[model samples]
Target chain A: MSAKGVLVRVSTYAALIVMALATLFPLLWVTSIAFMRAPERFAGTPPLWPDHPTLVNMVNIVHQQRIGYYFLNSLIVAAATTPLSVLVAGLAGYALAQAKFRAHRLVSWIVMFAVLVPNQALVLPLFEMFSAVHLINHYAALILPAAANAVSIVLIQAYARGIPADVLDAARIDGASEWRTFFSVVVPLMAPMLAAVAVLTFVVSWNDFMWPMIAMQKVDMQTLPVALASIDREHYQNIGLMAAGATVAILPMMFVFLASQRYYLRAVSAGSLTD
Target chain B: MARLELQRVSKLLANRQVVLQDIDCTVNDGELISVVGPSGCGKSTLLRCVAGLDKITSGDIRIGGQRVNDLPPQQRNVAMVFQNHALYPHMTVYQNLAFGLRVRRVARAIVDARVRRTAVRLGLEALLGRYPRELSGGQRQRTALGRAMLREPGVFLLDEPLSSLDIPLRAEMRRELSALHTALGTTMVYVTHDQSEALSLGQRVVVLADGQIQQIDTPDGIYKEPSNRFVAGFVGWPPMNFLDGDWLENSGLDAHCIDYGIRPERLLLQPSSSADAFIAGRLERIESFGGEWQVEISRNGSRVIARVAPNPELRRDNELRLWFRREDLYAFDRATGRRLQG
Candidate 1:
């Protein structure tokens, strides 16, 4: 509409594009390094693209580092965590959203506060509890503790609150029980948010290193991030092998985010806009 | 279908402000009752309380002569259509309509038959496969109605069911609902703040203000003989004009009359005369409404409106005398706002 407006619009787009590249450059650089030979990867002047590309690092990680076992372990932990987290969060969210119970507001406030508490604070207590229960080097030590997430509960509660009370009334009037209403009406209506929350929780659980490292003393029980860190430590000068291990750890989450970006965006926007 | 009653009902918020106070009313089996009020008057809260959605702070509600105050919504056999339609966004119209029945473990064949019949009845048959977001406002409303209808509850609770539609669609749905009530012979309690909707759709209208029932009567009786100034002022568009004046002590003036009230359309223009029901005023403005002109008149620092047939004789700044039959006047107690029963 005006010269100044056009100039501002163009600069805004250019700035966003530049910022996006700046954020994504590290991941791209790691992926490029994963494809290079050790000579090119360890060279003083790192090449943007490998002149003599090789699959040796990926090959070595699979055979020597046993990345396959770690991959399976990560998948098991994430698979165990995501659905359990969604289920527990969904029930808690629905109760918070629809049920009229004493101390409801106080409980919701506590959950919101729980979201702010650092996971590191819980690590020591959880470690102590797991050790007392003799769950060290066991997958249950990792899987069971992640069954509930404060962030997912908050997201679901905010989403479920948007559902009109009358819909529940209609369901109840038709002789549907509270449990049935949750399954039939609330669950279906909150599907998009559930998908987004599941993916986010899965990514968090899969990439988690501190808790898994402390719990799983055995090498076979170690998840991808712990396994990747071990590989980096063992092969300190092998940049290509480290890059390959990092790429494996990062690929699944990238795919998950790409596939459900719409739901993730909508869920995030809905959470921010609600009172 | 069953008779319903709200007896000595009251609702106080946690801060102890009464949102609904000492409400009492009853509907006969298969009768439609409309509750009308301004915003924040607890009409929706009252409807929710009746539908078992809101807890009543005190008092009992009865359906079919049985107390339902302690019962949950499912046990109460009441269906509610919400103001915003509240259709499930992910479900098809067919799924939405059948959800309730399926939840009840109704036979699949029966559920299918009822949904089909309701869709046909509400003209939603073709739209059954479409989701809520795919339909227009009117279609969504019809789907909501269809969902409630399929439940076949003892009582129907509609909360401003047509408020979201366009003006023309609202009129169409109003007629449709009135006709459906007659056909189904179901006890319906509809809530709306729109006077016309309350008047046209209700067999009896309950006017609410500040959580209290002001009047309960048939639409005609309430309009013709409002029980108080609040009801008189609250009902009817181009609301009844109020004039502040002392009762005349002359021979023709009645001793019991306090203030005079007249409907806008009933106030006739007349030349200056010694008529018992006459007011002298200056015409200030005229609004033409196709068939009739609404004239605003000022008299002795008081304003009044009169609906008159379009006329070249009426002009702004002209002195005018407004007259009507003596029987058309209402007398009310200025201190208490209660109408002095004629």
Candidate 2:
């Protein structure tokens, strides 16, 4: 290669590496501190690498702190919400993308407006309504409120716009009912978009703190994020224990993102191109 | 198979725009009819209405002598091959072919046998296990055709099925479609925007323009005796030549109309002294299309095209005399654009 080409390539890779390190340094620091022994964690000049490694903090968090219960509660809420939200969004997206209704434009405008509204703004009203129904401390408070995600519906609708309408019409002519067509034909075509939605919704529900804290006031019913915050309030001086708790709360989201990153990237890029 | 009929069918959009206006036609059993029109002329809309995908605002549709205006698409007992060959991308060729039968609750063994037989017929046996994305365009089209053919519906609707294929493949598929129609002996309605396809495929052709039917007749009749100026201009390749009635009257011809039409192939070059020589013009350009030649002539600021056999002696910018027989001419009223009787 020419000297100029080689120089340009080296600089481009150098810039990328610098950006990567800038983004990952905080996470690396947290992980390193989580593994350090208590005496070395808060030394005068903090070490990037631990002098001595230990698993006692994680063990203590799981055994004595009741972290397992909050973990299971988070898992259940996320598991229940993902499929329910995805199904509702998929059906509504298909209707908005393909069906010819008199109020199509009006409905689309409403959905767009809903997407623009902040979820934090709805917490007070939702709390009031759930309290009136006596569901404030129940798991239903977490699952039912997230059933109709406007972002997921709009993402699915954008992805579904690439599918030709004739295919659905052909399915109808082939003796398949509308419900059968959706399940057998449309769902498979939108699998990647659905996967992206599932991952995002799972992460959002798992990492949620404010709403879960407001809804689940009892210590036994609180989710992992809420439980972590409550423990941090009392044990703020225990850096290692707090780091371990943060790592545990973040592990599932990392695994999910890694597992479905391919579909997630594809869905995002396709959505952008169509828009 | 059974005959299909549309009586005074019309469709209006929710915004009160008329999309189809009083469309009337009949398809006999074992007959193939081609609907030809320009874009936005409602040919596809008409097909969708018949397929029960869209509802008509007025009139009735009958299939097998039973009114089916309110019946759902599945109950209409008709199959359609879409223009884009809408095969399920996630399914294999075998699954796509057997989808309709399986949906209808056919026996598993029977479904397998029929799918195998159809795969063989369409030359897709070796590719049965491959998904739609892995197949070529022609294979995808064949899979779509097999999907419809396996149902054995009373009527078939094909909407511009060959529009996506290349020239050579399109001709081959056209012949294959004709042979398939003959073998099945089922009523079919084919929609296309290509004039040549309409002329070559069906026994009868319906020409539409601006959401209205211009003419419905045998292919030969529609070509030779167009009902109006729109069909005359739309159903021909080079289009017919239209001469003003004022010019004809001034040239000492007895023309009692506002417009005169003649097919490009019927305009012949003649000597100036010939008794039948009708008009004189200068040949402005000559384009050779291998076996045939297109000659453009201009006279008194008016232009017309003449299609003739390639002649080595034809020269550009030469004064030419053109003539046509009385029977080859068509006259129309200027204001209404309707055919005037001779």
The candidate scoring highest on lDDT is 2
Tens-digit per-residue lDDT, B194-311, candidate 2: 9999989989999988889999999999998899988988888799988862436545655564678888898887533333646567899899999999998888888889898888
Instruction: Write the residue-wise lDDT of candidate 1 on B1-342 in tens digits.
Output: 999999999999989999999999998899999999999999999998998878899988999989999999888988889888877777899998998898888999999999999999998999889988789999989998888888888999999999989999999999999999999999999999998899999999999999999999999988988999889988887999876553232325553546667789878876334434666678999999999999998866778898988988888999987776777777888678889866
Clashing pairs in 2: none
Question: What are the lDDT figures for the candidates, one per model?
Answer: 0.87, 0.88
User: What docking tier does model 2 reach?
Assistant: medium
Worst 10 residues of 2 chain B by lDDT: B270-279
List the candidate 2 regions with Cα displacement exceeding 4 Å.
Answer: A1-12, A42-46, A271-275, B245-252, B271-277
Candidate 1 chain A least-lDDT 10 residues: A266-275
Give DockQ per model, in order. 0.52, 0.53
Candidate 1 reaches a DockQ of 0.52
